[model samples]
Target: MPNIPRNALRSLTLLVIWEMWKERNARVFRQYGRPATEIVDSIKGEALLWIKAGDTALANLLVRE
Candidate 1:
């Protein structure tokens, strides 16, 4: 989160929490399981998707410096 703004941090936190919760429910209800690295990658992918969908400037900051 270094060099990222506070709002980005908050959004990232919520995204991560929601992803983890959803994965947890899947594991419990669907007997699904995945590696931790895969989950982390999914969370990163989701954050990128949401950022691109919501804020182009932020998306650029994330990807293009």
Candidate 2:
């Protein structure tokens, strides 16, 4: 899974779920939609943001992967 700590992975999971829920609501309420690539990009960007908020080594490792 990317060799991250359990807590880090959990944080990432929660962030992804929250982001997905937000996107779902946006699609339903605002008729907004996004492509798969965009969604993946968003997730990756946010994951990096969360990672950056903590350790730089972890972020660099993830980016390398």
Candidate 3:
């Protein structure tokens, strides 16, 4: 929680929740599941998409120091 903007934090929280939900559904319905590392990678990839879509607050929060 590195002093991220509220919007950025909200976006991240929702992203995590959505991903977890999808994983749960996949496991329960499709008998498929991904490792936690893969889930984190998916989140990173999706964050890049958000950045491309002009979410500067998210971009700032994600940037390496």
The lDDT per prediction is 0.79, 0.77, 0.86
lDDT of candidate 1 vs native?
0.79
* RMSD of candidate 2 to true structure, Å: 2.7
**Considering every candidate listed, which one attains the maximal TM-score?**
3
Q: Model 1: per-residue lDDT, tens digit, 1-65? A: 57777766677678889999999999999999889999999988887888868855456557745
lDDT string, candidate 2, 1-65, tens digits: 76677665667677779789989998999999898789889988888777768855546556666
Clashes of 1: 0
Candidate 3 lDDT, 1-65, residue by residue in tens: 66668887888888889889988999999999999999999988888898899988878888844
Query: In every candidate, how many clashes are there?
Result: 0, 0, 0
Ranking by lDDT: 3, 1, 2
In terms of TM-score, which candidate is stronger, 1 or 3? 3
After superposition on all CA atoms, what RMSD does each candidate show versus the true structure?
Answer: 2.4, 2.7, 1.5
How far is 36's C-alpha from truth in model 1 (Å)?
0.5
Candidates 1 and 2, the one with greater TM-score: 1
TM-score, one value per model: 0.75, 0.71, 0.86
Candidate 1 deviant stretches above 4 angstroms:
1-4, 56-65
